[model samples]
Target chain A: MRVQFVLQEIWIGLRRNLTMSISLVITVAIAMALFGTGLLINKQVSNSTNYWYDKIEVSIFMCTKTSSNTSCNKADATQEQKNTIKSDLEKLPQVSAVEYESKDAAFARFKDQFSSTPGMVQSTKAGDIPDSFRVRLKNPEEYKSVSSAMLGRPGVDQVVNEQEILKKFFRILNGLQWAALLIAGIQVIAAVLIVGNTIRLSAFNRRRETGIMRLVGSSNMYIQLPFILEGAIAGLVGGILAAFLLVLSKIFLIDRLQGSLQFASQLSWSSVVGIIIFSVCVGVLLCALASFLTLRRYLKI
Target chain B: MIHFDNVTKVYPSQNRPALQHVNVAVEKGEFVFLVGPSGSGKSTFLRLVLKEERPSQGHVHVAGKDLSRLNNWKVPHLRRRIGCVFQDFRLLPNKNVFENVAFALEVIGKPRRFIGKVVPEVIDLVGLEGKAHRMPDELSGGEQQRVAIARAFVNRPMILLADEPTGNIDPATSIGIMKVLDRINRTGTTVVMATHDAAIVDAFRKRVVELEDGRVVRDQSRGVYGQAY
Candidate 1:
């Protein structure tokens, strides 16, 4: 094949349909960016789940003098009740380890956790946080057993499983991921249709050339090479744009979310780069394939 | 170099067969004029030689290969050995005359220097020497047809098929076009041209095969175009 001839043909085809080509590039870029974002959200969700699942602990808060529960009756649990509760939690197979936090220690831990916000630290008194037992489960999924056993005990005000809260947060992240992927799916369909339309129009415009080529014994592949390369070039440009969009999304969207949420693990730069490469490849392949199929129908040779 | 054995062509949408039970042979270096009315399958006969349309029931052999058995991938190879010209002078409107002629070689992957040498030579042969830089729109109908013929003949194929090469040109201009085809025929390329011009046929006195309503009514050697049978 004459490389220069094919390249010249591609240049002519693209220039002839400049507006359509621009729109095709933009559509492909949006589709690929959303696709990359979906993948990034997928990565973020998995990273957070891995980072947080292992550290999940079920907290069993004991009654204090301020507690008005039926079991506590606005009185602090006695020493015997505390011992009994801690011993019971330790006896459960699901409970791996138990650490008791006194009221003063709980208040100190709260201050330490909220140290970034001085207003929250200043408003919380020592007695505001009740004493609690932090239970680590061998299997986080078995938190139900430990929580059920500890709830409504004479010394216990309430039991909370950290994994449940994490599940809710992760659920929201999963919804966002699905939403991104869904929009990406629609955009991909749009991009593919545009690629097909562009190819058909180009083929129609150059029907005279192609007819002459067919008469001169030019092979089908020789005739199709320029059109296919046209799509691939458009795809390459769009993919480059999408790479920029993906990087920006990581910096302004994901990293910012991590900054505010403070629990999601950091997404590595290398992984973002990897996702960018994958999205670009997908864009190129999709465009090439779409044009190829379109040509098969519109171009007889 | 071209043979049709009991050939028949039937299009799916029409009840009438385009060409029916036709048998004819044109040897190498023969200039044969296929004289027929509009629906008499003159174009179909030329199309069969180019493998553009297949005979629904018979066989077509070009360069001694059975066209029915020719694989789809091998069709281009078969077409490369045969040149075809259409009534429309299917030249790329955007390309100049030289570029249009060179496009044939370029599409088939000919080298630049080789195209540079042969394109102008063929343009000179077709009597379009200094008009190489003009586009199709700038050239007259006869000049455009000459460019189309040049493109078809550039690769030096063994056979040339012309379907109404003079269909749209004036009589004076068509005479020039026929002279070009005649010159190409002298170089040992078998030329089968379909035309309704009885005057050119009688003037050339080449072998004439006349068709009427899909069947060969007469085949005469060095014959003039006869009246409708």
Candidate 2:
């Protein structure tokens, strides 16, 4: 009720529990940093996946002279078979566009793809290349249906999508993001519990003082206000420290990664800023709630 | 100002009731001594008036309001009208005597200017005028008790409850504490004090209420501390 006295008591309580307060700050800071990082990385991963999905093409390889699959054993795909396949693909509602790649075009693409390695180009010949149909689907997720439909068709060697190749890479990014988030979850819980324990200890230590106040007609909120403020201040400090760490990582780690990864899309500042604000709010609010509940349970007025 | 109608108290951990069939009343501006031995419900009597403990049966009333019917949130308001002191002289080790006394008015949302004016008056009333800046640890046991009394009386309550106010102090300092309590009583505030100090009880020669096994065995005006042990 007395604002000045309550503020003074908060300062005193924080000072007296200096060690515990410091530890609580550090714990909340570390947890918030990890939480922000996890959020940012998740955004990055999702952005990367969506970008790659648009570029994904369902490649339908045609039979060639060296092809060994039963579907391709008879001979190179005849002109009628190739025409039939093209018409079939166009008829499917899921197919957006289709491009035909002849053997000569495949050989040219192979050479250009291996231009950096002269030996790779030297080892390949025109007849060694396979003709294919590059099919773009209206929805990338429908690639599964296209792949299955073309699997055993006449003169078809294989049906493959680019997403399958990038699966290994996306798996790693998602795994890292999940691991970071899981650890952050655990750390946040620990931070809340640490705040709770610190409040309980301070309450126990100051029982004598509070008992006197209770007798002197102080309300429960009046007695608990100082401790709640202490927890909130510590949480705010932790949030600030975490925001600092997140900005540092963005400059030193993420920006540099984007420099070499020009093909990949980067997350916007709003997302990082959003995460910073969210973590800070969560830190302060959660700690205050924990401290308040702890006082209600243990620091009876 | 205070009344107990056949009040009985039973703690969950103890089989027997602390106070049984207790009926007592004290008028406004009266100084009453509650004399009893160990485990004879002195503390319980004070606690009931403060609403710290609810009676298991019967009713306790203070300021014409039945405590059993009082809302939990209204307890603080009720206590604001009553002052309480204890034997341990529970003082905040971090605060000085002045701050401790001012704490009472501060919690009840008094303005700063008013607290500034009233803190010194109560400190002087408790006879600790110059020692206002002394921390609890800096004061003697008696002076600490004086600070507790100053804190309790700073709000100028209608009633004052002292549970063993002199239990932890020596006979000489205990007299000083008694004199301060008596002085506060003379200022038109009803005073209810529980004590085992037979000397102070007999010397003060006020209304004496003796309890034995949770029942009032003797109550008389201008009475001495009768040898009932």
Candidate 3:
């Protein structure tokens, strides 16, 4: 019976403070949306680092007539020179596998990789792309060992480790994730302040009722329940709205990016599901904490 | 039912104590009038019995429980045995008369079945039988006080504390409110009222405990409201 009464009281309170409740719902939704975006960015950064680092290779470019390196001043690498270089790379314990790419094959792979960037793909000629030996490492962290060994070798123009390029990309991703997190933090604090103010206002407006209730022997918990429930309802509504916006953004934007940029790793289904659940829980938990703390401070009864 | 042993209450922000070494006791089922001029510690006396304010140097015992020794969590149980009414009536503006009365029992976790039976019975006893559906704003001051009285009595408290229950109403309404208190007292509920209404105090002819500057100046059985010094 008391539960029923409390529910009725909560409903009445929400209705009476409809505008405040609506603003609270919107604030929580926006805050949680930013939080969800931060989570996604963090996951993307980790996923890309793991996905790319495992497949990253060190490329030893063979000398050609267009090459400027003094080390590659000689004629194009012969079959014997190529085979000997490949054998030497394989002899190194850190070298997992070595594959030779001719100029034709390099051009073909470049075209395939940049197919979506039609302007850049069309600008490249058959001979413009370099012929090189792609060396996979047992541990990507050992890229330094392979690059130093291949550098200055006869008939080699350049030794480029894919991990170096990936490192730069990951640095930018990490910075972006941190920036997103900072934004989310500010927004969550804003949402909490609004919620606290709304609770305080509601408590002030109902002081007469609470004063009477206290005089008639009502417990503190009984007086606080309705206000707490008011906050929770706003949070629950905001959580639902945030989840919807998150999923909509994923479907309309992220999914399209995933389709066109197939080489980049996408977020896993289970992790996305976890994010949705986390968004809802965080919203409710934050509002509950805010409400409880504010009420304890301001509600005399 | 109520005892104050050398109770002295010095409000922290005030230079003078609200109650100073005051001593008073009321037996069960007695009607007592706590009469005093403004700021003579009548409100403080009632507040002490309610445990709303603790005595700075002494102890208060109400309904067989020592309030000074009572845990804050256990204060509610002590309060449940005491009913309080005020000059303002303190009725919830949104709720009607019946709901205002039923709210007292509802808060204490009383069974709905019990509330359903006791609320109407008490409302009838307060003689607002047909005004149960009227909101507090829709009723006269006397009727509103009756609703407050009904709420206090619906819990069947052992002691009823009224801090100037008739202060806001006219004399005609004041008499009606007093008669309701009289009726409730006749049913064996101890009554303690704080007021400045000399005529009502003199007319009731009950035990009057008058305070002067936070000290009890008079304690007379069937006393009259005294003249100003």
Candidate 4:
């Protein structure tokens, strides 16, 4: 009837079943933590994909004096030929930016990019580098058009899109994401059943009280609300614990694990906050559902 | 007030009916006793009046509501008018005597102000004024039953159905419980108590209804327990 009356009953019932309540809270927290981790990783993968995808460019390497391509001749490209190629690429509607790199400039860029991998840089000679045009497209999907146009040119050796490599990386991350989601789903279901059964036992133990309440003209809502609130209280506690665990994981696990992987440093603060809120909401909703279903059969009030 | 018209209850797996074509009536403010040996349908009769079990055939009307026609949602409202005291003294063990008494009012949404006044008054009526704060486990069998009686009467129900209210207590304690019931009945509340205690039955000598093998064999005014046979 009154909110205070219902709350009082909930408090008393929860106190009587302290062990069951604690178990429910722990189970919910663990399950929500696993679920939260999976979601966070999925979010990180998407964020990183967007970050890298936007920066990806198509590289067209031109044949030179020592190149193996048959289209290349002994003489290198003249300044007019280089200007013509850059002008043609820039004229295309899809081409946003086209920058040419000379053999020496390309080599220097390669050394800068692979500065940490000195062994890789030393194994290759400077003349082995080819002059190339780095073509940035307005849309990454136009990479195919740019590649087709530049592939058969007189001085072209090959046209390579770095987005293909990123695609392969994303495929593997996606697989791991699904695997984590499946495991998280199973744990959530198991947690729900555990909470449901615990509430069932509490309902069974207090069946006489429920029966008396029914006899004394208590409404179905009045009779059931206390048990529902009990489950929700357990869920609330679990949610708090889950938020704590997620925050701890972000601070300790993600932050520390980033030291081993350079890109993981990009995991954002918003992602951590999102995981905490999402985990707590899931915990509360699942526990409420479990309590509702479990009480339906037992409480007949 | 209560009325039964040819009510029959056949429990699952039992060849004979628990109650067979039984008919009885009790008007407002009347005190009646249902006396029978164990397994004679005394409990079943009480349960039927409360709609705990619907009659297999015929109608059970209590407090002007036809229980056979009543919806599930309406059953609680029906029960609100009829208070029940069980033989086991079904008190919530965790609750103190005062809480146990207050629970009845709480369930019906009585405001705390009303509960504060009515609970102590009912506790005093049951001679439990000093033990209001004692838990059920802390009380003796007689005191526990008294607490149960207090809970039953606190709501001022229109009809009280007490099933063996004094069965577990000694004769002296049984007398104390009988006096409490009498006091409640004096306030114009109908009391239907089912008991097998013949000594108390003879001493009270109120209207008695006797049941045997799912049938009413005797109904008399100021009757002894076994005078019919």
Q: List the pairs of residues colliding in candidate 3.
A: none
Model 2 regions lying over 4 Å from their true place: A45-53, A61-94, A100-133, A139-157, A166-173, A248-264, B227-229
RMSD of each: 2.1, 3.9, 2.0, 3.6
Q: Is candidate 2 or candidate 4 better by lDDT?
A: 2
**Judged by DockQ relative to the true structure, which candidate is superior, 1 or 2?**
1
lDDT of 2 at A226: 86
**Local error of candidate 2 at residue A135 (angstroms):** 2.4
In model 1, residue pairs whose N, Cα or C atoms come closer than 3 Å (at least 3 residues apart or on different chains), thus clashing, are none
- TM for every model, in the order presented, reads 0.95, 0.86, 0.95, 0.87
lDDT of 3 by residue, B1-229 (tens): 8989899999999999999999899999999999888999999999889888889998898877789889987777777888888899889998999999988888777889999999999999999888889999999988998999999889888999999999999998899899999999998999999998988998889999999999999999999899652
What interface RMSD do all candidates show, one decimal each?
A: 1.3, 1.8, 1.1, 1.6
How does residue A56 of candidate 2 score in lDDT?
A: 80
- Which candidate comes out best when scored by DockQ? 1
Tens digit of per-residue lDDT, candidate 2, span B1-229: 9999999999889998999999999999999999878999988999899998999999999999999999998898899999988888778787888988887788777898998999998899899979999989988899999999988899999999998999999999999999999999999999999998889998999999999888999999998888653
lDDT of 4 by residue, B18-115 (tens): 98889999899999999999999999999999888988899998888888889988877887888888889999987899999889889888898999
What is the DockQ for all candidates, taken in turn?
0.73, 0.57, 0.70, 0.64
For TM-score, candidate 1 versus 4, the one ahead is: 1
The digit string of per-residue lDDT tens for model 1 on B42-150 reads 9889888888898999899998999999999899988888888878998888789999999999999999999999999999999998999999999999999999999
Question: What total of clashing residue pairs does each candidate reach?
Answer: 0, 0, 0, 0
- Model 3, A20-75: lDDT tens digits are 88999998998887788678767877887778878989999998777788766656
* Span of ten consecutive residues with least summed lDDT in model 1 chain A: A256-265
